[model samples]
Target: MPLALDVLAQVPTRREAVREEYLRRVIPQFTGHSIGEVQWSTAHGDFHWANLAGPDLLVLDWEDWGTAPVGFDAATLYIYALQAPKTAARVRRSLAHILDDPAARVAELLVCAQVLQAADRTSFYATLAEPVRCHLQTLASRSA
Candidate 1:
């Protein structure tokens, strides 16, 4: 996954998977930090299990590949992996360089907001709602 992300980082595109405006709106609502600025980079906008393959790491769904918050991919994969504690831990560890940084906080909160918003409309992400909320609260508290 790291290699895939590395390669994607080299690909160029002007698209923004997570727009600054969206972050401006949601980040403050959730984390209480008015977003000053976001670190953007090329990313697999949708970096979840369904979009990845085994044997050799294959990242599918190029449709959303574009500029995004610095650790968007790592934050996304981390959020999706929360259902599996061990897997989530591994992702957190492997991507600690990204996840541990304050810059990644925007990505994490954005992903959480996406999940929470989706939960309001469908049950697909409902199971993750609480966990995501807990994570958001933790982040919000940090900023406070």
Candidate 2:
């Protein structure tokens, strides 16, 4: 499991206190919800489109996988699907079937995910986006 804090540590603009508060609220909800260990047959830690094959959906980039949660890969796929409306709908349906409480869990995780992503200074936000930075700032202010 990627320590949410450790992931956030790579982000430059992160507010530590706010991040801690967010983690404190969410981590407990997953206390006993372990996804167990993943023994990958060549798992890709960065299994995004840039690393995959076009002919068949053979997942590439086996650097980030070791003992990740079962659905973490699926979650990355769903996030990629968000770029396409039709695919996103399919992904949502698929998630609904697999996850017991998908809605609530997704909502909570989205915030944390955004915060984690925002911590990466070289992300799109560092150059192109301001809304995410602004939103994080707002979250920080509210927490303050």
Q: What number of clashing residue pairs does each candidate have, in the order they appear?
A: 0, 4
lDDT of 1 by residue, 1-144 (tens): 456666776778888787788878876675455666788889989999899898887878878778998889999999998878899899999888788888888789888878876886788689988888778777778878
TM-scores for every predicted model:
0.88, 0.43
Best by TM-score: 1
Quote the positional error of residue 10 for candidate 1 in Å.
Answer: 3.9
Candidate 2 lDDT trough over 10 residues, lowest sum? 34-43
Query: For model 2, how does the per-residue alpha-carbon lDDT over 29-121 read when each residue is reduced to its tens digit?
Result: 422122222221212334344666757555566555432322344445544544365875686576553323432343223333543455456
Q: List all candidate RMSDs to the true structure.
A: 2.1, 12.2
Misplaced by over 4 Å in model 1 are 30-33
- Spell out the clash pairs found in candidate 1: none
